[model samples]
Target: MFELLKQPWHWAVSGTLIGLIVPLLLILGNKKFGISSSFRHICASCFPGNVKFFKYEWKKEIWNLFFVGGIIIGAFIATVFLTDPANSIRIAPDTAGILNSYGITDFSSLMPVQLFNWSNLFSIKGLVFFVIGGFLVGFGTRYAGGCTSGHSIMGLANLQKASLIATLFFMAGGFFSTNILIPLIFKYLQ
Candidate 1:
């Protein structure tokens, strides 16, 4: 069921709908909708006294929090109930080949995969790579003053110049890293 959602068109449609909703959110309440803000909301709930991280008048936006919860619940329902039976066969050749390279040769073998497989996920090699990758992502987000979607979708929609430059750099950086650096690094590791 979750496999059907791996489709490109499915993501494209969802992204377009999200973009549509951003304007509605702005018009209805003048809120710049984003995912990062949700983290802040959660933090405020856990540590209301901490002024550094949990610094928000989050109590006023309880309804917005409910909307976020709805999004999470809706995603679970879509994954479990709306997934197509032919999803495994509908997988892209590139994705299938990538999975095969990782020793996951069978599409049927992919499902019911373990989540906390620490030996594989937290191996010496895996952990170091994750630390470096996570650091780079955090650095990028900080250096840009916000995440890609926040600056690109919401910022550009409001005609913010900083966001435009950041969005272009983000796109260029993604293209170079994915098309060049990622393959080089993966080949060396293999």
Candidate 2:
């Protein structure tokens, strides 16, 4: 059972579970499935000051907090218990060669130490990858009114036009970043 858990499952297995969540949440209590709004709930619950945005009755959405908590707990369990020490990332030869060209040969962990370690945190590469990228993601999530899972999964599941638009933009942005922005950053910034 532990060996099975350590092995990568078929994408369809998890995809089906994720797909089921929309109807399950709706069936349970007409609850919307989203992770981004939990941040607002945390702000409201912790700092209920004069911030008009977080002034709502966030207690009504307390279940969302529990849902997010479950995700965190699940991650901890998977990382500490389910992970196989011998298993390493398996990249395609061509992909690995391209990455090697970019001076990112370390494939021992999920993130390459060259780009993700504390020593590189203050460097231009790290700043662009972590700080700038994080800010853009946060800003995009706020501006779009939801994160990728919220808009692409829950919103689209509900047949929302706004969500369809948001998901399209999300795909386009991802393509642009992967094909253009990332290469430029690695080449010029690194």
> lDDT winner among the candidates?
2
RMSD of candidate 2 to true structure, Å: 2.1
lDDT of candidate 1?
0.67
Residue-level error in angstroms, candidate 1, position 116? 9.2
Q: For residues 1-190, could you state the per-residue lDDT of candidate 2 as single tens digits?
A: 8799887667898799889988898899998888888877888899878989889989899999999999999988988888786886677898788889789999887778888888878899879988999888877887899987799999998899999999999999999997899888889976
**Quick one: best TM-score, which candidate?**
2
- The per-model lDDT (C-alpha) reads 0.67, 0.87
Q: Could you tell me how far off, in angstroms, the CA of residue 96 lies in candidate 1 after the best superposition?
A: 5.6
lDDT of 2: 0.87
Minimum summed lDDT over a 10-residue window in model 1 is located at 108-117
Model 1 TM-score? 0.65
**Residue 95 CA error for candidate 2 (Å)?**
2.9
Residue range 1-190, candidate 1, lDDT tens digits:
3554553346678788978977888888886765545555666887767476567678876656777798899978866676554554456889768655545555652351432245646654355456666667766776677676678888888899999999899889899976777666656655
